[model samples]
Target: MDWLRKLFSSPVPLNDSYHLSPSYKVFTSAFDQEILAKDLERSRKYAGEPTASADRTWRELQQFWATDLALLQAETTRLAGRLQPSLNLPKSSTLTLLIDHSGSMRGDKIQLAAFVAEVTVQLAIKLNLPFEVLGFTTVEWKGAPVRDLWSAQRALSNPGRLCALNHVVYSDFTDGDHPNSLRAMFLADLLKENVDGEAILWAVQRAKAWSAGPHMVLIISDGAPVDDATLFHNDPSYLWSHLHEVIDEFGIDPDVLLAGLGINYDVSSLYDTSDTITVFEDIHAKVLPLLENCLRKM
Candidate 1:
């Protein structure tokens, strides 16, 4: 598995605008499907600690956000006490946030995500709901390493998803009670390409395994899937089409309730329950209402 990770994890130069030619897919190779084994699907995915030093990144958030976070905690406390119990989640339900850590989420978007994380924690605590804060991004900028590996094997057209899938457990269930768990969202370096379809599928699969009766997952992202490595080799709509398929398949399941939050991006196309993506500039953004709307289905 370490070898597999190395194959996909290595960074290399890539052409951003590379797209498949009409003839590219006409010709196929044995290596077209994957560069390695049947297990690349599992081996290429990572969900663990930040590649950077945790202590340093956590302290960075601590120093920069001490006052604001304190205020946020106080506000959440106030809201929790006054809010009607109807706003609380259904009992025995679990919540999970499948966030996009794409490069486009870098500056203000990422910062707001941390704020969202704080709010989610507050909601979980107030509602007595178990939750997880998870994120997804590629290991590197493009699929160059993956492509290079495939080329080394035998160049082929329509090779899907050359980059390593990185799913992050920024804060797992029960960790909401801990102070530093959300700090994983503050790591700027973890922000990279987003493959929303796979991330959503992974989150949904994990959530389904965790609970039988009720579970709610909220996907937060600023944009659609944009992994250059994949789009270049396959159809331009390859990832987007897969995203729609995954959502359409499980979005309406009886046991699971799913909603999407577009961070200033229009994700209404992806999730029928999700409205247009908006920034969390103020309480007026209806962030809480959206969460309430999703959980209401549960």
Candidate 2:
């Protein structure tokens, strides 16, 4: 987890011309096959027997698709070389990431989320993207307000620092419903008061600003927004109003948001590909294209 800063030497072309390592390709193919098989088996059992065990098996598969595969792909990409032909990427592109730390996020679910979040920021750094990470929970501290929140400070150069931040954030709580209200207020203040909304404003004044031109916000959660209504405006049409605030405050067009809805608690749909991976594929398919479109619009 060392960090190196250098110009893109053997620039990769923008036509999706990046190549995968032979070892990586073989490994991923094998892994995909195994996952596909387990998925199929679980589906068959649930289809034939309709038992709770069969249902549980199906849910596991869904979690893997929704979280694990994304992390694996990201980790592989980080280990791989960055593409060149230089898209003139911003020197720093702010990536503000928030992962759920609620008590409910224990066991394999949290493990998977942690893996994905870590791998993703790692890849972003390897590609020389500037980013920040945060974790939240409601578990109280002594003499502290019920809504008190904490965050790992922003780092400018060290990838290991980012990784370290990831570890600290994840380590703070055990698995439960540790949602903190003060965190949201802090985030709002950060967005509104400090950093001028240059990057994604976070809770407190602990904003992560990118030296790069534009920024994006990435959130990984279990569809549980602690202050969902307040975070955004109350209007239903404004699904991502806070996002809009970032865009306006920064005056950056097409600020991107990439989110992975974390593992669902209900186990019934986990093993079902049709119910899970299909949705994931739909979302995954949209990401690259959406980013490309945003870049163009910008």
- Number of the top candidate by lDDT? 1
After aligning candidate 2 to the native by TM-score, how far in Å is the CA of 26 from where it should be? Answer: 52
- Which tens-of-lDDT digit does each residue in 80-186 have in candidate 2? 35342435556544544555554444444454454445444544555555555555432121201111111111221211100001011321112112222211211
RMSD of 2: 20.3
Candidate maximizing TM-score = 1
lDDT of 1: 0.64
Q: After superposing candidate 1, which stretches have Cα over 4 Å from the reference?
A: 1-84, 87-91, 174-176, 275-280
Candidate 1, 1-298: lDDT as tens digits: 4554445433333222222122222111212221111122223232234423434565676578777667666766665565545554455578887778899987667766766777767777776777877778866677644655656655555666666666767566655474354555555465789878767766776666676748888888898799887788788987887677667767557777778777788777777677543454442355666766776777
TM-score of 2: 0.38
Q: lDDT of each structure?
A: 0.64, 0.32
- Candidate 2, which ten residues in sequence have the lowest lDDT sum? 23-32
